[model samples]
Target: MTKLGLEAKDLEPTRTIFHSIVSGFSCSPIGRIRLDLFGDSSHFRREPIWFEVVDLSSAYHALLDRPALAKFMAVPHYAYLKIKLPGPKGLITVTDDYRKSIESARDGAKLAESLVVAEERRQLDRIVALAQEASTAPIPAEDPADKTSFKPSKETKKVKLNPEDPSCSKYVVMGSRLDNK
Candidate 1:
């Protein structure tokens, strides 16, 4: 209607903020409405828009039925839900498009998780194969000392041990325990 001029407002989730804007809007005759919406990660964290914690594994049926129940859904980063409201005389039909944010978040998270799992599985398989190869391979044996050509020195003495003598008990021969005769 020849540019009725644009009206802008910032609405918060709380009643105080909503009431300030809504009250003013409701009183005036409704005209064409154009909404420009955007939000950061902090907005989602601050607002209670996202669903509460849910068990992703056991909640399979629930997750399939409700997108908000999916744990992998990304936090809302930004959104735009522009609506062209009808004047007092005009009529317009409105349907929900907010679910798109949650669906996109869930799909993105699922794709990222799948990629990570695939990489982890590939690394695990490589480690398992290496372990198997190590188990089957024979280890090289250490070389034994050569004693075929070795001879005992003449200086080495062998003495018979007397059980009655305490001094003889202290002596050990050839790295073996002495037996008292």
Candidate 2:
């Protein structure tokens, strides 16, 4: 495995390993342990969390030459010296950018659905308002010769219904249906 750079004490602080696979190679981020022997536990404990390199596809490696491949293959499993970078103090998390974009698209679709439902609700309310207006508005006066002409009246007619009759009791009067004496 030494040919593949796997050796004793091969493990070290802030080191990354590129595992050779049948298809290609895969590597992860390298991090070092904190050596705060004299300090408190806050600075002593450490976790092994590595962030994988981005866009390291098989097609990308296929484009590289022998010398370049050998150089990359020789990378030590651990960092030989002190390694420090700016930004995140702990392990850096890496994720697929394409996946993130897909999630954002799904969120946008859900928002669009909700907006469509709201617009439909507003349309229904408008139709209901129009119906109410049509019901209460005064009818236009017709020609005196029109036999079908009917006059609008504010007076409501009361119908005498037998309380003991099942048919009359079961039926409910609504609007002007019972108002035309």
Candidate 3:
């Protein structure tokens, strides 16, 4: 492979190893953990969860079976780290631009809500002003036709639903027939 920078092979064994460990180590907001750890229908949907890089290499070395870690990885895991990022919850990440984006969303929502509220208040103020004018205005002498036209309708209508397919109640599915009613 073509060498870049100081060269990949030139990296110290320990430094290279540390970088590997750091790359694998991850953090996550608790909500993601509860989604995975708790379950699909879990109640703690919005909680923050945190995780840290485990020193598993140390554990393997302490066990005097360093190769076992690889073997352990071979087994199918009923429970395993989600590990990857961005699909709802796997790892925690932070960046200047990402934080700014989150803040921007919150600020934008608040600004929108405030603007809506202010407009609603302005509308209410106008309505109040109109009400005050109407209350103070001289009442017009009532016309006879005005009283008759304001009456509520006393007529009633009946609506009935026809049974769906009298020939086949068992096989006829509900939503397929749009004209049943």
Candidate 4:
């Protein structure tokens, strides 16, 4: 539209919705426009094309769908990366440039990488926020009354293993308290 010196207001209002496999949800078109598309000097088509205006950055200006292809009666050869359409002189063939296709693929990869980085950054921010909240919270105080010292519940007798050494004495539980196996 900018290349043609036309604005969005110039397009006829439409309620038509468009969807793509890349984007799962349906998009409402900004408007509909009838433009003359030329494959070559001999082959030209005037067709109504729907446009969905978005603020996202993209490598391609517009994506032609089945409706546009049907309007021009074009047959696309995926293996050859070319489209063949009927013309007054002969069959008009439109081929994609290899360099442009490579550049577009590179741009698409960069876009996907940037989106992943942005999501990771958001998750990091959330984790940082949670850490900050936890740090600012008050720590609970310990109760002094709950503290206790360890004590033995059973009575024991001291017996010297070596009679020559009094320091080698070992403590044994009372025989009456012991359970018989």
Candidate 5:
């Protein structure tokens, strides 16, 4: 619209909302406009298209949907990366750059990965905040009379390692509950 020297006031108000499968959200269109689209010098189409003005950055300026294709009576061949439509003189065919398409796909993949990482970071931040909150809470002191305290069940006797050297003697504690086998 800016490129064509058109302002927001020029657009016809639209109440329609559309969903993006890739972004997983719904967006209300800014407005609708009947723009003259040219396939070539001979083949041209005038279609009313709804424009969703997003705040976020994108790789592509505009993404045409099935409705736009249907209006032009265009058939897209994905394998050949071409769109064909009936022209007044003959068949109007538009070809896409293979390298540019690959580049765009790569950029889209990167954007998706970055979004996932950002979401994961947000979750981790929430978990950290919860942990910090938990850590700040006061803990009760353990009671000496608690029955859950660990205790050895067997009685033991101590035997000195060196009987001749009493000062250097080290004693080993042996349990009476030992089996002879």
Candidate 6:
């Protein structure tokens, strides 16, 4: 239809500041609300022709299944969707493409996560390999200090630990706690 020849009523979203535009829909109790990103700061010049009246509960599902949520953060954020209204000459469509920003953020986040995960895995693998190598390799020989080479002073070793410390009765304990109270 020649809506251009007719009056052109701008619209704005009452709920969100999305770039969505609607036409030929029923009015609400508050009146028609068309959320236009191109709309002025006052939002007074705009009026709603119709409402999507969506519960929006299914928006997530729709975004995931239809819009391929994996592709981008198509979670019905503000400043999305496009509007093609009846202008004086032709259809005046206003589109705010937020896809680039959304994609940029998403791609950066994914890359960062992947790099972190890969680095964590690499560290874990190195630790595991070191543990395995330690298990397989033979222990280093303790170089015996010749007691004969040292001269005994007037103060002899008189502490005389009989059976040595109780902890020395067995090998060293690893991790958490030890039953040896």
Top lDDT hit: 5
Clashing pairs in 3: 27-92, 29-49, 30-48, 30-49, 31-47
TM-score of each: 0.28, 0.27, 0.28, 0.54, 0.57, 0.27
Backbone clashes in model 4, listed as residue pairs: none
Model 2 spans with C-alpha error above 4 angstroms: 1-96, 144-181
The per-candidate count of clashes, in order, stands at 0, 3, 5, 0, 0, 7
RMSD for all candidates, in order, please. 20.5, 21.6, 22.9, 9.8, 8.5, 19.4
Candidate 3's C-alpha runs over 4 A off are 1-96, 144-181
For all candidates in order, the CA lDDT equals: 0.38, 0.41, 0.37, 0.66, 0.70, 0.41
Candidate 2 structure, TM-score to reference: 0.27
Superposition-based RMSD of candidate 6 using all C-alpha atoms, in angstroms: 19.4
CA shift at 95, candidate 5, in angstroms? Answer: 1.9
- lDDT for each residue of candidate 6 in 35-136, tens digit (9 for 90 to 100): 322233433223322333322111121121223322222233335555344433444444444665566557656655665687689999999999999999
lDDT of 2 at 120: 82
Q: Against the true structure, whose TM-score is highest?
A: 5
Candidate 5 pairs with clashing backbones: none
lDDT of model number 4 = 0.66
Q: Number of clashes in model 5?
A: 0
- lDDT by residue (1-181, candidate 3, tens digit) is 1221233343323211233222333322111111122213322123232222222322111111224323222222212412112224433322224444456557656655665687689999999999999999999877787565565344533322344655643432234324535
| Model with the higher TM-score, candidate 3 or 4 | 4
Full-model lDDT, candidate 2: 0.41
Model 4 lDDT tens row, 1-181: 6876778887787777665423333456667666676465456554555555543344455566898888878897766768888766677887877677778778777766766687689999999999999999998775555345444555655445566876775654444455545
Q: After superposing candidate 6, which stretches have Cα over 4 Å from the reference?
A: 1-96, 147-181
TM-score of 6: 0.27
